[model samples]
Target: MHSYFGFLCLVSYFLKSLPQVLCQRTHANVLTNETDAFINRVLADWNSPGGIAVAVVRKDDQGAWNVETKGYGAATANGDKVTENTLFGIGSNSKLFTILATGLLINNATLSPRLEWTSKMASILPTWGLWDTTAAKEATIIDVMSHRTGLPGHDFSYKWSDDVPRLIEKMKYQRPSAEFRDVFQYSNNMYSVLSYLPTVLLPSKIPFTRYVKQTIFDRLNMTSTTYSFSVARSTGLLADGMARQGINFSDNPFGGIPRALPFWATAGNEDGNLVSGGAGIISNAVDLAIWLQTLLSNGLRPGTNESVIPAEVTEKVSAGVSVQAGAAQFPELSPLVYGGGAQRGTYRGHEILERGGSIPGFNTQVARLPFDNLGVAVLTNDNDYGSFIIQVIKGRLLDEALGLDKIDWHSRFKALALTTPPRATPRPTNASLPWTDFITLTGTYDNPGYGKFELCLIAPKHPGASRSCAALASNAPTILPGAVEADIPTFLAEWDNPGFSHIRLTHFNGNVFNLSTLSSFPANDSSKPYWTHGGDSSFSSGAYAEAAAEGRHVGIGFTGIWGAGAGVPGPIGSTVRERAEVWFHKIPYDMDFHLE
Candidate 1:
């Protein structure tokens, strides 16, 4: 009787301990189906076009690694499904690779001591002329990487141009947004310039793309990744790009009746021939997992004795150099700091390193919790919902890894999206101002940072369209699809060189004017510019011109959002509330003036 009783007690004890042991193992190696379901549910709920792919890698209790991959929706509207190998633009995530490549060159002792991060740009690229020599000379490589150069994002400078060298040459004209090392302004142009450094310095004369591939991608066996869109397409791995048909929520299929957008319309459109250090890499979830694993493993290849990136270099590159304000929408993640190419922050008591990238039709996010030995990479093709979807997935994954109760990220994000205010309607135009009101506005405007532009009054084609001195003009013929028609009263705003030249403007109110292209304005708002075409297109709410310097000058502010498509929210300050403005001084058409 005693022996039987002891056996029963032992069984009870073992039964109680079994769950604890299993739970520990599960925390390390196991990913619950509920987590997968949640990811799928979020993507489905968003009705993400071209689908989404996610890769997760975590370490088991015994130090062994496990990888989980999930793909939801189709890669194309024709029903081709997303897979682990489907290629998607990684966007600015490419910046991290560029920074890593720089670190590698430094590690290899390829750069001279004088060319270190603290070295002046003028010293490094001496022949590269700069308008503000003093400020340019004071700017350092570290300043560029950490975005403390006081140079605002002159994103429009290269938004549609493939000529990187010309872009670099134009940098001389751009003014700093703030004092040296005083503020953080993300600048893709800086990174694009930085990408050329390795080619200039390397004895072998290899391009930046080749250098990255050899040192990083090749070493890590990330074969599916490349900086070239053509290369990705050649491999038949690139996913089709997609966009929403109309801006209104009523146009959303999931919201009410299913309204199909012109999916796959932009499937094979080429972004450009040039490589961008800031936002050009194309990759897949499978390869990105390897990337995260290598990073988390302290620059060593997983399950191998080979060292890829030096641990010291990784630490140096990721060390916080500049502080960033916490995201208001994501209050849980606070104290964000910008490092070399990554962001360091704390989420729910766990330290994390994260980076996000967005291009025309793709959005990507890679996040790591080093202490937990967990990492996640998400790639999606839908620009509108991509950012929100990625965040929800990351949050859910973190909850699972940390054994915390799951948060309803999907519902919260959905609510936020639905609650976003609709675009404002333009007020009715009942009054027309006399041509004398804008008499002083037509002149050559020069900003040392942005160069020269001219605003000219166009002669009216129709008798009723204008008076003798009226500044009325007509829109240009359709250069892009869905552009404004030529009959609208317009003003020709031309840039000195190519790119963003030939903007047609129509008067809206007192000093405000609307931009029009070749096509008729949508019935919703003819006063606002809409970018229906894929890729980088400029849009504006309106341009407001005000007299300054007691009529000596006119300050024109181009207020609107700029990005890939119409009706999509871009980076903060991209809306009409903030604008990129330039001042025009009345000068002789034939007279030449040097910008101070």
Candidate 2:
């Protein structure tokens, strides 16, 4: 069976390499009944009600391209069905634009240093420094763009309100989880810093927004795709984002629970109000069709023989620069490698460059098969951890295109995705743990890298996370999912952080708390959370159980001088990204500090 499948893959590659014969099936044939059924069945099986826009572009005979675009499910509550042009935020897929925009500068370099992949960041920004002194001085444009920089994503540390320059200044303070180029650590902060490079590297000193607009957007004629939601909304074609009920944390299906989520907006403006360098772009299949073809042609403008994305730029962005996974995740694929903004690996013997991204309510995936001259993009207006459903869908699409044997991609991934691990045994709490234990530590604690937050004594009606969200925090019990009314002198970590209403901290032991420990409730409601907090996206709208289909949790511990001073070794941030636990010593006022 394995040899037969391999023979089919080889034949598919050979046939694709041959010049397209007009007698061959049209591109429309790519979306056969089999493909459609596969997509629908997986979506139904996973109980995903929100819609998705899928576009497939393939090189035909004579080097021309053929396309098939379609939409499935409702994009809005008014029952407006999703179509080829409905705009949905592509999330971190915007990183591709950042890399292509960098390619533009590289192609048109007139600077003294002549910025190339190897140009050291230190020369570009004197402020660019990191705890890894060697990496701080030696890291290059490619290092940051490829996420080979020592820093992990210290996502929560970013001030959504700060301008690019200030954000660049804050980069130095973010601790690094590994030495330079030791391992691949995905960092939005690293990508976020690249957004500012246009302003610094070129004589025009253009912000990323304006520079990419002049260079890439106009070149591709993507008028509908913009960093601004206002522009997308003006078309009256923006998709209303959705999430599964109780999915913010529960893995089980809630009857395909679909709830409308707000488009990412702030102070009555687009999500671009936050940051565009990392994750921020609203586009549809129409514009993305052009993008996929461009990638398929290695940056050419489809059949015109014109280069919209300089060929050199295209090559560098898609070429793998660092190892993401040291071992193959499956027998069919090669070890994963992150190119510039996306990932590259083989799938069932076909080479593929791909990436998956999501914000609070929207999830997206894009792929390029340079070897076969095929490309695909899927924009899903529903929340998912890694956009896995689309991942499964795309795999089957490839198999259908190649005429290979069907594999149960959905069931295999579903089992892996939905399998709930046994809950950890709870650490015994101090039997006499008193309210005084909470009150004593109820002050601002600070980290040089992560900054500061006030851990409050009350349930946020007093000493709120911020006065701005106080009313919301006070009413949080009614709004937040899995509402935890902690019985053992629980406290709330209140901060007026954008994208977050409040976080509930429950007592675990003497001085530690489980950030994510929760009590189950009937979370399958249509109404979205009044607020959100997440992995790397501080996108200030919609709901993200960001813990995802499973009740994912965060943990925090306060023990004998437990941070920098206490000699806790390693970086602080999500355990997924950090080398050690995040810690912050209590405020200076808490001298000799066991204030009970």
Candidate 3:
């Protein structure tokens, strides 16, 4: 009877410890096979023209990590293959590195404790002269990093310019989208300021790029990572950026399939020929794996007990600093929080930290599961469809690691993508409406929130062709295109950002028209918000009239979408519910409009 009871106890103990024993036997080979198969499946599902590179690092029971990289598609138009060493633009993933640099500065005691993370911008940059004295006085380093400054993205204002100082100066004109420290609004302009702040505060007068390299990159041994466009171009390992062909068409929500853009050989050129602290860091799967390992280990270099970033600093930066607004796409990940350029959320009851980046030609995502000591970084040249692939792969990997049921992320994403409706076809304009109507619409328009811009009527280069309008000039100079019109009677609307300068208006009725941009995608359904290729501007109404007496001849109301990424669904329903409406009023051509 005693022996039988002991045998029963032993059986129960073995069953209780079965999962742990199986997990211990999950070798590097098993992980590698699973990850490779998962990535291959994702590549096949996405069918992107350009290459994608992914690196997954998992910590073993002994505290060391097993790293693996899987590369798919061509790295360059010239047919160079992607490898672990192939460098691709990491986009906003640069933000995490920037935050680490700031943390390192604080850890080193180079910055005063009070000013390290919470000092007011006005106190630190008193001489720079911000237009909004109130924001300048109250916005802190922590506020900016955590995206709680109540500022809107204002992405259009400095999309093409490399002048950081001028961009900072222009922030004065941008109004807050929310109350101070009350809501979350992602702002790259704010991050640009954060990256440059250390340079201003540090006594050595070091440039942001140099300071980051000397402090963080050098310490982590990220030898191939670079902040300079010229250096990235010089390296043969740099991957060529690719965008889908026919991206301007509204019918093609998937960006019309990726094609290599050899002109975008270097990633840093998008920031106006300079290294952008916000979205400018070029690295590869191998180097990024090292970065992930460092992050997972709480800023400690693996194998060598050397601490690159202080553990306390890492803990503070990773902790929630601001509550993210609304529910995320995955309900399990609700109540998101932002801290030091990374977002923290719960995934199936496990802690997950992530950040993603989208530039003109590249898309990237980096995620870490600190509790599991696992990390993944995905870089792709195809901007439009890359996010979908990354999210799918990340989700699958996490599910496998956590011993959760495998979800069909590919099928789910495909269903969502298929549900997205193509842009609405514009109705034919009333040819009978006199040309005088268009003539009256030609003038300069001004918005206090934006700036002065001219709309001029341009005669078609060919006879018997439609007359189009040209955006001649703007208070913001880099966006000027010198009065060139489209082949049709297209009117180009100028947003604060230059990339959003291509909206076309087709007349639908008297003094009313249907508005669309080269990048506009139709709503997935009436329940979902319309997707724009640029992910910024959305036209609410395009109308004009001959109101010569009031100086308000033409008016356009547009709602700007703030934080939607490539392939990500924006807030659903009416634009009014999700974004702020910006109004532009046309003034006489001779009138000198001024912004308040």
Candidate 4:
């Protein structure tokens, strides 16, 4: 069976490699009865509590296409459903524009990929140092585009204020999280560098926003897009702008009202400015379609005197960046790539140009099926479950645009359900006990990045091991799937065992001091004072019980620290690029647990 599957895959790849003839003939429509069923099923699985908005676009002929927009609740409740041209905040999908800006500069002979934009490289912005000295100095314009700056994913300590000088000053004291050319970390700060590139090249200094508007937006005629939140506010889009903030919630099949927070208006910078390489743009679907058309035409504008990106530069940008294989591992985040901030390779046998964005309120997706000259751009005011919708919708439409194997999206959803582990209730307090000594097991503990924890460790089976489990300090209930008991000392050490699916703890030494030491396996509902203090108190008691009772999903609540976004780490601010430092919270001292 493996050999047969491998042979089939090879055949698919060979067919995929062929130009238009075979590729066009084999296009499969994903909008069939089966496809519709699949779409509905996946949406239901991922939809959760909040509403969803979806849009689909496909190329029917060389110059022909159609667009369909659908909304599940928010729009329907207000008697206003989204249309083909409904504006969306395309979050970090705006980074591609930063790359495009670079391409434009190169085309105009104002920038060179080979030139090192460092102090020793004869560039003007020598003070704007690359994160690494040796290898960073050697990096060119292309490396920055690939997100290889040695900085950490974000700087949690810096403020996301609208002041550029403060950001630049703060960055001066910053350091690199990783060694240069060592690992691919998706550093939005690199764009902070790119955002300032125009200033370095210009005889007259220009803010990042002006550079984008004049060069990229003006040339492409993306009239609707702008980098300034003030402009968005003036245009009567404050509500929409606020809605685009990327607030996150539990991963339950029934998602709840997200922790909506007000976002400060920020000027677009090159890194995360109102116009930098990361997110910070708002535009409608129509203008973006033009942008897509330009990309599909390989840099050529639809009807114009210029190409949006030079062919060589476009290839340079598209060529895969060096990165570690397998998905990025961030707490609570589904695995995704850590290179260049987007998945750039082929998906489902098509050479796909893809990008997605997640901000406080906005979630967006843009993809181009180059072979079929098909492109799609989806933007939504709410991001709660937008990414899933984009993937499902795109998978369906691409099947139609290019003849490929019809995927049963519903079956995939079914497969998702089967794969999710079953939740178990904790063992009853009265079930069994070897020795119950709970006095000397509470105190404060600390780890650098994860922060401090207050623990009340208990020897549930006391007189068995040590009288006091030094390392296992928390007295908090230790909840696990199903129900099992072992020595507290041994369990605390191996709580993070490979076999365990879910385990939380209260560390007296500061890291997770109040998570899972009080309860035992799958307690559906308990009224113990589990958490007293420390960390961002984000989860509600009802929220946890509600999620666990559902069994389909389990929400392991982590305190809110800097860099809280899933996949995206640290805080985003208008600062120079710096080292990637993982942040941790401090634990309180009242709890009675001791360090080993």
Among these predicted structures, which one has the highest lDDT? 2
Q: How many clashing pairs per prediction, in order?
A: 10, 7, 3, 82
* Per-residue lDDT of candidate 1, residues 211-260 (tens digit): 88888889999988877766787887687655564445544534321122
lDDT against the true structure, each candidate: 0.64, 0.66, 0.63, 0.47
Worst 10-residue lDDT window for candidate 4 reads 542-551
Name the candidate that leads on TM-score. Answer: 2
lDDT of 2: 0.66
User: lDDT of model 1 at residue 124?
Assistant: 68
What TM-score does candidate 2 get on C-alpha atoms?
A: 0.82
lDDT digits (tens) for residues 358-418 of candidate 4: 7645667887777766776655554445555555566666665555565654445334444
Give all TM-scores, in the order shown: 0.77, 0.82, 0.77, 0.60
| Global Cα RMSD, each model | 8.0, 7.5, 8.2, 13.4
Off by over 4 Å in 1: 1-32, 127-134, 159-162, 250-275, 326-328, 422-425, 434-504, 515-580, 583-596
Ranking, TM-score, top scorer first: 2, 3, 1, 4
- Model 2 spans > 4 angstroms off: 1-28, 247-252, 265-274, 421-424, 427-436, 459-473, 494-500, 517-580, 588-596
Candidate 3, superposed: residue stretches over 4 Å from native: 1-27, 30-35, 108-114, 127-134, 247-258, 262-275, 425-437, 440-488, 493-558, 561-596
